[model samples]
Target: MTGALTVRVLSGLTELSLTPPLARAIWGEDDGPEDPVLLQVLQRVGGLVAGALDPQGQVWAYLVGLPTARADTQHSHRLGVHPDVRRQGLGEQLKRFQQTWCLERDVTRVTWTFDPLLLANAHLNIHRLGAVAVAYLPNYYGAMAGINAGVPSDRFEVVWPLGGAHTHAPWPMGPAVDPLRDDLPADLPGALALCVPRDYYRLLREDPALALEWRQRSAPLFSRLFQAGHTLVDVDLSRGQYLFRRTAC
Candidate 1:
């Protein structure tokens, strides 16, 4: 499955049927199928359910979103790309396509929750896509399996503004600090940096105890910073750092 990919809306049962296997393959779990009834309802209610197909008509990636109470906003529910085609810019392309799909339907903002400890995802959402983390949710999913099995399902609620201007900030040149390893700076500037493990999944597999320790350690820090009017606005993937800025009230 190579060459130019085509993205289109997945409407009827036939197209939506692919969501379950795709999701299972992406997460490496049999965590039940995506509810077809719900998908039907969402499709009927102006929601966005689309997938990207390779040249041979194989669905390689998919994105699902639902309309929010506000007409101009949509809640991004899921995005998955086949492991084989990842890092080929297909995930980013699917996201860009989703943004365009939302804009065409008069939606300007998209919201989603993602694990804060996943540095790669953090980079993709914040630095690459310009989404801002607005809140920290502790144990958001209660309990789970697959990639998120052991640790607390803490998440960062991100907001992506489709029509707003996004400015790319310069990377921080200060000494990098790992919250899991080093003491946090006593005097934080207008901007502060926190680092997560480059391979959280490996940490989970090799040291489940340490993985849980990371969640226990970072949750309060992120919660406190968010309460103090700080927002995660960018990430430096090279250093596995998440940058938070004090937002003006």
Candidate 2:
């Protein structure tokens, strides 16, 4: 760890003065702390990683690379915002920085996963930026240990089509005019439904009942669509929820 505010790439091991508390501060306490010991071990193990800096030589953010295997075809580790300065658009900034970093390295794709139930994150991933929530992993984390420990940790694996603009099938475009009316519920006996990250989290917080209701209600439609041969790729975080545009039928 060198001076204040320099995005230095460390060759071996560097302590950026950032800790796990900082990570918990922003993303909630359960996601794991940004501990130096843990990070050192992780970096040593392998991954493209970086530590954020401030003017006076203090670490502000921590960026890690999921080097071994990307969440999808491309993309490395999950991005985390310091608990203190989250919502200041720092996470997005970090991601864009990572995206560019990946592209420069000849990595054409980048992917990450998130709880589709959490609405704010959903908005952050989809609406403000352009990411997709194509795959839904039920109980992805098994049992989350931190802040979100009480709830189910099912995650939506989001993919950033950094390779290029994704070629989507001609599924009817949305603002669906009337999703409730035009989009008739497909018949899916055993299927999982899409949940916007932030919104889903909010439901867990604001109305656990509603979240429960959605899990059951969406099963049929989501399953039906998939069974009918519709593919939910790069979900539309463009609006608020995990809106998947059927790329193939």
Judged by TM-score, which candidate is best? 1
lDDT of 1 by residue, 1-249 (tens): 768878888768777877888888888784555776688788898988888886676778898898989999999888888888888787788789889989998899999999989898888899889999999999998888776787888999999999877897665667766667776566666788888888887899899999998888888788988988889999888878888888987
TM-score of each: 0.93, 0.68
Local error of candidate 2 at 226, Å? 4.8
Model 1 misplaced stretches (Cα beyond 4 Å)? 171-173
Name the runs in model 2 displaced over 4 angstroms: 1-17, 34-38, 41-46, 69-75, 127-129, 165-184, 187-239
**Lowest-lDDT window of 10 residues in candidate 2?**
188-197
lDDT of 1: 0.85
Cα-based lDDT for every prediction: 0.85, 0.55
